[model samples]
Target: MEAYFIGLSFVLAAILYPLFIRMLKIKNIGQYIREEGPDLHNYKTGTPTAGGILFILISVLFGVILKVPLVFLLSLSLFGLIGFMDDVASIYKKDALGLKAWQKFLLQIIFAFGLVSLESTKPIFGVEVSRTLYNIFWIFVIVGASNAVNLTDGLDGLAGWVFITAILPFGFLKQDIFAIIVAAAVLSFLLYNTRPASIFMGDTGSLALGAFLATFAMHYNAEDALVFTSTIFIVETLSVIIQVSSFKLFNKRLFKMSPIHHHFELLGWKEEKIVGIFAGINLLIALTFIVYKMW
Candidate 1:
């Protein structure tokens, strides 16, 4: 059953992407390149975006059909909606800045709270936490994961590739068919999203993928394992934090740019190379953890 659905979602994503890209182009909905980003990315300006809407739609439909927990679908859709809003804001404003940091953060908090509302106090990493603390921790995970994936989405197909490796562990560890199904859709999206991309996932896809990763872990009591599954995302996020802190406190910049991948871009690494390396690292981490668990 799961295999059938996975194959179906893949074909659905593949078929819908071209039509979606055409509609986005016709409507003039496209990406706005960040002026401060790598010069190589300037060519990507005006490329069709919000391509994530299709996969999110596919995932939600399958999630419903499979009768996965309602909370899972709700969190995924809400976070994806936040991303869609961000993408729209950027398009409307004609700039890369979409929905002020505080606005997006606040919305994530609200929706993250909604996600945790379905659960009471629970053990986190084998340690029980108070109800309030449990709420706060999971909320942090959801919001942080969303932003982490958003930050990682700078390069073509980078986030999508990393997400595939990051989420597949759930399928192996807990037989979570939804994880496998989403992975299939994401793999299909990468066909167009790779280097010299036809469409970008923008914030819409990245945010939702991150949210789904976190919510899936939460559902399975795999929060601790998420650190391993999401190693690349954590490192990417930490690079930004470390860079910012260094600049503020030490009057220095750590990497050529924050998020680390941009640093590699500056180093003359091909976008495809960076994506491949990062995704490889993510896969290695996931497989290592899976082995440990199985043994």
Candidate 2:
């Protein structure tokens, strides 16, 4: 069943790729490069946006068919919709920035609350955790994961590969259903999202992917392992946080550029090479966690 879903997701994504391209052109929906970002990214302007919808759709289709869980489907779709709105706003405003921080946070909180409410009514996997704590944890998972993926989207295919690699630990724990579906979806997205991407996942796909992984972690009681599993995201987000803090606090710079990847780019590393290095590190971390769990 898992293999079938994987293959099915790949095929479905392949079929949808050209259609998405047409839709993007029809709607004139594309990305805007931030002036503050690396000059290398200037060329990426006007590339298709909202490609993450295809990824999310593929995963939801398979997940629903497999009867994974209502909460999973609801949470994934709800978050995806929020991301979709943000993507739309970016394109409409012709700005690289999408939703305001407060706006996005409010929407995320609503979705997280909805998931918590659902989980409270029918606890997933029979795991016992207090409702209030669970709600708080869910908020962190949803918001943290969303932003992590958003930060990791610095290089082409970097976020996709990192997400795919992170899902492996969950698979190893036999908590494979949600992770498998997510892996399949990301694999499908990678068909176009690879180096020289045909389309960017934008906020729409990244946030959805992040939220789904967070939900999976919560479901499996593997939230503890998420730290190691999501090491790449943590590192990426930390780089930005540290950079911002240092600049504001001391007028000092941490990295030549934030998010760590741009620092590598400024150091003469090609985008593809940086992505490969990060993805490899993410894979190693995930594998290490899986091996430790087995022992």
Candidate 3:
């Protein structure tokens, strides 16, 4: 039964992307290449974007059909909604800048807080913790994971690969059909999202994937494993933080660009090479976690 649903999600995503891309093209809605990004990316301008909407829809629809808990679906949709709004704002403005950082953060926190508030205020990792601190920690996990995946989406097929690997262990360890379905759907998305992409997932896809990861961790008591599974995202986010801090405090630039993948791009690394290496690393991390758990 799970296999049937997972296969259905894959086919659905495969079908939805081209249709969505055509609709976006007809509506004259497309991606706006960032001014500060790699010059090589200029050709990607006007490519159909916000392709993440299709997978998010599939996940939610399947979640409903499967009778998966509402909280998980809510988390996915809320974050996807945030990403959708950001994508729309970026397209409307004709620039890569979408919602302000603070605006997005505020929205993420509000929704994350609401989600965690409903969770039991039990001791974390068997350590007694205050309710305030406990809620704050989970909120941080959700918000942080959302932004981390968003940061990692710089390269073609990068986030999609990492998201699949990162989420698969959760599916396997927890016997979660929903996680499997999400991963299968994302795998389908990668068919069109690879180098010389036909459509970009934009913030909508990346943000929702991150939120789903965090919520999945919370749902399965796998928060510790998530830190390992999401190493690629963490590193990508850290690269941006380090670059900004170094330039601001020491007046020295650390990398050619932030988000580490762009740094590799500036080093003349091919998009395929960068995605391959990063996804390989993410796969290793996820496999290691799986081994440790099964052992």
Runs of candidate 2 exceeding 4 Å displacement: 120-130
Predictions ranked by lDDT, top down?
1, 3, 2
Which pairs clash inside model 3? none
lDDT of each: 0.92, 0.83, 0.90
Preferred candidate (lDDT higher): 1 or 3:
1
- How much is the lDDT of residue 148 in candidate 1? 97
Question: What digit string (tens of lDDT, one per residue) describes model 3 on residues 224-289?
Answer: 788888999999999999999999999999999988999999999999999999989998988898
TM-score, cand. 1 vs. native: 0.98
Task: Record all residue pairs in model 1 with backbone atoms less than 3 Å apart, i.e. clashing.
Answer: none
The candidate that wins on lDDT is 1
What is candidate 2's lDDT per residue for 1-295, written digit by digit as tens? 5677777777788888888888997888999988899998988999998888888888888888888877777767888898899999888889988789899989998888877676643243456667776787778877889888988987889989998888766676766666676687678778888879889998888888788778777666667677778899999999999999999999999899999999999999998899889989998988888889789
Tell me each candidate's TM-score: 0.98, 0.93, 0.97
Which residue runs of candidate 1 sit more than 4 Å off their true CA positions?
none
lDDT of 1 by residue, 189-233 (tens): 999999899999989999999998998888888897789999999
Error of 2 at 242 (Å): 0.9
